[model samples]
Target: MYDVSPVQLLIIAAAGLITSVIGGVAGYGTGALMPLVLVPIVGAEPVVPIIALSAIFNNVSRATLFRDLVDWRRVRLVILPALPTCALGAWGYTLLDGRGALVVIGSMLVLSVPLRRTLKGRGVTLGNGALATSAAGWGVLVGGTSGAGIILISLLMAAGLEGAAVIATDAAVSTVMGVLKFGVFGVSGVITAQVVAVGLLMGVIAVPGAWLAKRLTERLPLRVHTAILDAVVITGGAAMLFRAATF
Candidate 1:
């Protein structure tokens, strides 16, 4: 169905599987990593749409698997304000050209590393009002980019969620937001047959990742995992920036 060679298809599947596992363990991975693989093959324009559709699959799996742990109140807080902003961001994304798309994606990925660290280190607590306001801003950021899930996860953590609750809540909120973003993309005329084909393929491959991540989360410390992931994200982001400059 794809013009991509079998090897590239295999690479996509492998990246999905690996990132799914990472996302499962860390509360975010597929968004950050998938863009690295997808941009090279599909170009930057389709990368977010591809991941946006696939995320409905990834987030739903986590939400379902961690259903009991979800804090629906937090989900509601994030969702209400994020919806409109998210739609706006997706529409803005549709306005970008290939190089602009690469720059946007790469800059977000790069900025996420330090932003995550700063948020975690401060361990800042957001009151409900602040949380809602923050979610409003976050909607615009995540709606347009692939790697900004870390912002949502950290936002949940600051609002008094930890461990499985954070993952579950993030997943639940993400699923809803994903649907909204997908609708925006569909109506904007960016949702192509290949986007559907690749998204579905990645989604199915990523579904089992949550269960596996559950097993690993209980046993692993995640410091190493986080460190390695940070390196990869930075490397990938830098590479994308380089390509953007050269392009």
Candidate 2:
């Protein structure tokens, strides 16, 4: 376990609050920001569990705020394909080094935007087998990379979801993904007691931040919120690529 100073803890808490707000509003940015912000403070080895915990807390808050807007049909569409694949990816993650995983994750982040745009307005019907395969791909990718939520969110947006429905359903699906990832991390011995404590402390800060963002999203202009979300995603993707190159 790495030792975090009081000042560093404060910084992390502040970052967590900001991350939570972005995630609550957009349902994507927090996970992407976690590695960039927390790894230096807590050390790289501890980042995975911290991200997993934060994802769970962030999604929980988003789900609560937009419970009424959740789209079960779309949620099922993504998860049915993503869950099993995520588990397999998680298993593979434990067997591989961080650098290899980072390369794949970074590439995925960079490509996700164009991929989403290409699929937009296609109206491809996803049957059970197709859904499962897609979900599995997402899961594996998510399990391997810290920013899977961004890819999933882009796909959902491309599928024509809007407003609270997108946020709520994304939160619901992320909740499941986070929980499963947490279990995988535990089984892989990556989640230590110190890591859990720090993650939970960060989560406590995230809850209020998520609530504030949810309230703001209710009142703010949709274009402004979406613009901010897009900026965050682009920033995150760039950061991931940088890390892949340097780490």
Best by TM-score: 1
TM-score for each candidate, following the candidate numbering: 0.98, 0.84
Per-model CA lDDT versus the true structure: 0.91, 0.74
Please tell me which predicted candidate would have the highest lDDT against the true structure.
1
lDDT of 1 at 157: 89
Clashes of each: 0, 5
- TM-score for candidate 2: 0.84
Q: Clash number for model 1?
A: 0
TM-score, structure 1 vs. true:
0.98
lDDT, candidate 2, 106-179, per-residue tens: 56556665565455446554554555566667788787667677667656665667777888988999889889
- Pairs of colliding residues, candidate 2: 81-135, 81-136, 82-135, 85-140, 86-139
